[model samples]
Target: MTDGPQGEATESPTRWKFSPVQLDESEILRRGLDAFAELGYAATTMRELARRLGVSHNFITVRYGSKLSFWRAVVDYALAGAERERNQLLAEHRDDVERLRGVVIQLYRMSANAAEMNRLIADESTRDSSRLDYLHQRFIKPFWDSIEPALNGLMAAGHIPRVPTHILYFAIIGPALALAQNPIADRLDPVATPTAAQDRNSTADALSGLVLHGLLPPSGSETST
Candidate 1:
C-alpha cells in the first residue's frame, strides 16, 4: 500500500482499502449454462443460477433484470467471441471453396465447445416460444444468412447437390451438437477425458469429415477441397 521507504507517512498494507469491480459475470453465466442444460428453462431459477456462481442470490436479477433477460445475456456472453473466431478461420484461406470448407470444419470445431448453447437453442426451438424467436433473430438466422450464399454458389457450381439450407445446416448441426443432448456417440467410442482439447478436435474433425465428404467415393470431388 505504501512505497514511502522513509516511513514519514504511508498507508500500510494492513489498512489498505479494496473494492471488487463486480462479481465475474461470465463465470456466473457459464454455471447458468450448466444449470439450464440439466434443468431446462422452465425449471432453472435466477436464485439457483446465482447460488451456483457463489454470488448473492439477487445477483442475476440485479445485473440482468429478469430470468429471460439473464438467459439472453448468457447466450450473448457465451457466443461473443465466436463470430470473430469464425472470420479469423475464414481469413486463412484464399480459395472461395476452400474458405467454405474451412468455415464448415471451423463450425464443427466450434460446436465442440458450443454444444451447451446449441443444445439450449435446440431445446427452445421445439417449443415455439419468444425465447426461440430471440434466438432465431439474434443467432440462428444470422448464421444461415452468412453461409447460405456460399452454399448456393457451391450448389450452382455442381460442387454439392441443390438442397435446403436447413437440411444442410442440420446435417452437420444434428450430429455435432448431440454431445450436449445424448451419449450415443460416447457410448460408441468412449473418451477418456471429455473436456480435453485433443478429444474435442478429434470428435469435431471426424464429424466434419463425414458431413463434408460423405461415405461414397467423391470421384473427383476431393480435388475441389
Candidate 2:
C-alpha cells in the first residue's frame, strides 16, 4: 500500500513519426550529372541512378520523362552553374590580366572538380552523336561566345599578345584539361605534394600563373640575367 501510493508510472516517448523527407531536385540532378559523367550516356541507366540516389526508378522517369532528357538536364545544370560563376568572377575583377587569371583559375577548378565531365566530353568528341550536337549548341557555343569577346578585348588592349582566338582558347584550356585527365600532374611538378593534388586553390593558382606567364608579351631582353 505504501509503495503504490509513493510510485508513479512514466510514459515512453513515441519512436516513429509520419513526416516524409522531401527530395531535392537540384541535388538529385547534381548526383545524376556526376553519374553520367563517370559512366557516359549509353552506360548510365535510370534504375542505376535511382539506386545510387536511394529513390525509386519511377521517380526519375516521372520527373525527367526519359534517360536522354535527364542527361540533357544534367548537362544544362552543370554548364549553367559554370556560366553563373564566370559572370560573377568577371564582375568582381576589373583588370584584364586579373580577370583573365580569375577565369583561368575558375576553369582549372571546374576541370578538377568535374574531371568526369571532361572525360565524358572527350569521349563524345571522337564520334558524331545527337548528344554531342546538343552539348555543342547549348553549352560549348555559349561559353565561347561569352569568353571569346573578353579574350579579344584583352588582346585589343595589348594586355596579351595577339593570337588566333582558337589557338589561345586551346592554350588556356588544353593544359587544364590535360592536368585533370592525366595522373602525371604531380610528377611533372617538383614541389607538388600529395596535398597539392587534392588542393583546388593551389592547383588553380599554379595553373593561372603558368597561363598568365605564357600569355604575357615577350620581353625585349632575350638573355637571362
Candidate 3:
C-alpha cells in the first residue's frame, strides 16, 4: 500500500510486503539515478554506483549483468512510472476539463523536478542511439498515444476546441524544460533546496490558464483550436 505525504497509510486489503529482493532493486535504481544525474550517463560507472550504495560491484553485475543494462533499467523505470501516473490522472479526471487542466499542470511541475532524469535523456540522446530509440518508443510515443484520446473526447463533447493535443503537450512541457535547464537549487544554498511539491500547483494553474485561453476556439469560429 502507498503512504500519503502526511504519513498516513493507505487502506488496502492487500498490504505491500517489504521484500529484500525488491528492496535491492529499488536501492540500485535510486542510487543510479542520483549518480547518473550528477554525472551524465557516460561518466556514471557501475563501480562508482556500487561504492556510493556501499555494495560490491558484483551486486550490480548479478542484478543487471552490465552497466548498460543497469542504465536501460533506470530509464525504463522512470518512463514507466511517468506513464502510470499519466494514466491514473486521466482515468480519475476523464470528464472534468478543469481536472484535465490540473493534470497537465501537475505534469509540468513534475517534469521540472525531474531535472536529473531529463538531463540523462537529453545527454544520452546525443551519444546513444539505442537510448534515443528507447525514449521515443517506451516513453514519449506511448504517453501521447494514451493522452490524445482523452483530449479528443473533450473536443467531441464541446468542452474544448479541436486543437492538436500535441500542441497542448508542448505548451505544458516547455516551462518545465526551461526550469530544468537551470535548476533552482543550483542557485540557492544546497541545504535550502525546495521540495518538488512546493509551488507546483501555482505554476500549474498559471500554465493551465495560458493554455486554455490560447486553445479555446473563438465564439463564432467553426475551426478546431
C-alpha TM-score for every candidate:
0.76, 0.69, 0.62
The residue-by-residue lDDT of candidate 1 on 1-225, one tens digit each, is 556878656775323321221346577678888788777899897767766776666666666778888888888887787778766776777565776778778777777777788778778878978988988887678666666777777777677766666777777567766655446554565754434334777777887888777522275754223
lDDT of each: 0.70, 0.70, 0.65
Per residue, candidate 2 scores C-alpha lDDT tens digits across 89-153 of 88898776667777777877787677767666666766699999987897567667766767777
What would the per-residue lDDT of candidate 3 be over residues 55-107, giving only the tens digit for each residue? 66665676677887888888876665787777777776645564566566656
Off by over 4 Å in 2: 1-23, 55-59, 93-95, 154-163, 182-197, 218-225
Candidate 2 positional error at 105, Å: 2.0
CA RMSD per model (angstroms)? 7.0, 10.0, 11.6
| Runs off by more than 4 Å, candidate 3 | 1-23, 79-81, 93-103, 125-128, 150-170, 182-198, 204-213, 216-225
